[model samples]
Target: MKLLASGVFALATLMASSALAQAQAPANYGPAIPGVCVYYGAQTLAQSTVGQSVSTRMNALSQEVAGELAPYAQSIETEITALQQGRASIPPAELQSRSQAVEQRIREAQQLEQTRQNELRYTLDVQRRAIATAVDPIIVAVYQERGCGLLLDRESVYLMNPAMDITPTVIERLNVALPSLSFNRLQVPVDQQQAQ
Candidate 1:
């Protein structure tokens, strides 16, 4: 659960840094013109209604996974506490076996935690791709509508007129095109899970 929280924070931090970079762009790039435009893909995705829905859904899923694993965690903690309290009275051989069992349980819990994290990550990636898919044509349409010949990622630009940013237009069209997305946790295949 701590790992999941940290992962979410890391994602937020990355998005914030991206936005800051765009904000710090030099402001003297002359007046806006046709045939050239910038799009802040990260910011657009983060700010859009559908994107917020995805984020809310992901947090719910993370909480669900934590709840599902709570018993394993509790059981492990109980066993460890019992072992420590009775250590003086336990025979050496029995103590070794019990300790090994506890270790095995810990390892199993760790593996489960890792699997859950991987599933969450995979689910997020898939959803982000879906959102991107929905946003692509909208962006293209906006580009053509705005008569843009060069479409640059905001991340790649160090200077641009604020008016030249088509991100809001793209996001608006995306909200109309895809107001929300419904998805479930992606159950990664065994082979892929092991690879991760």
Candidate 2:
């Protein structure tokens, strides 16, 4: 078993509730939680690298909606700009018709954006929960081994006692014990109702 630093912020954030659980633990009852250690872990660096891919996936999903709406957006903006530049003067009949059409198109784009946003948001929420679930068993193993009373997100702790640091060890053990959720899973569109 490799040693793990428990205070890495990346893993810590996901395990913050465990920190509170630690505080509530009975004092001097070490026997009850043998092999338990007070620990934290970082996975931010790794997760951030994965996030770049996630970002790209989100941008790609936006493409379809954007494509559908681009002509409307572009046309409206062009007409507005032309009006500002005095490039075109419209009679009241044409002006009213153009204004209504522009409003309708704008609404369509806004609706599409809202739908896409909801789908992506739901997908992200599920994915994070999945990753957090994957890491839990490793946490339990380390807790059992170290006689740990609590676990915290590494980011929350400012001072690292080398004696207490177990990040690398935990990470290694976790890699073996638990398969990581996709470091970057592309979020695709879902129906607006399903997204909700």
Candidate 3:
């Protein structure tokens, strides 16, 4: 009688456990499958008109700036070569002074280069903002059309199915809507004066 009772208890516990597992299934499963959209900013930017134009202008500007500093760099280099080649008898004190002067000139050139590059970066930021501004509407439209709630960066994604990516359409629409960065991309979506 005790053995039969033990078997019955065991069967009851197993049945209860199975029932609990089934009841908890809804918590682990989602109501609808979530899909993701990915965008590659660098690739899209490279293909955009604003990006190309910005790159071209910056390259030209860099060349011009390099030209301005090239002569001083050559002078320093030539002095070093001359010192090495024994073209002149350099006294220890004189050599130290000359070396310091050359180093100073190189530092000045480096500072100028960095400053100009920073200025170029500012220019690029402005251009990028313009491009992003222009692309927003198209991105919104595409998002709406595709029923996507979220947009993701392509770079950070570790592992995702290729079917989830949405960069191509975004790139196409961006190119269509924004041929250049000269245009202001935003307009009044809602009347703000009325709110005041």
Runs in model 3 deviating more than 4 A are: 1-35, 86-88, 91-93, 158-164, 181-196
In order of appearance, the predictions have TM-scores of 0.87, 0.57, 0.61
Runs of candidate 2 exceeding 4 Å displacement? 1-72, 82-88, 173-196
Q: Clashes in model 3: which pairs?
A: none
Positional deviation of residue 160's Cα in model 1 after best superposition, in angstroms: 1.7
lDDT of 1 by residue, 97-125 (tens): 99999999999999898888888988988
Residues 120-194, candidate 3: write the lDDT tens digits: 455556777878887788777876777777778866764455455676787877777776654221222235323
Consecutive 10-residue window with the lowest summed lDDT within model 2: 1-10
TM-score top scorer = 1
Scanning candidate 3 in windows of ten residues, the lowest lDDT window is 184-193
User: Order of all candidates by lDDT, from best down to worst?
Assistant: 1, 3, 2
Q: What is the total number of backbone clashes in candidate 3?
A: 0
lDDT of 2 by residue, 1-196 (tens): 0001222343465457546655665554424333323444334224333333343454454555467567777887986676556536677677777777777877887776665555555555565565456556766776667766666556676543434545556666655554333433234545546645
Ranking by TM-score: 1, 3, 2
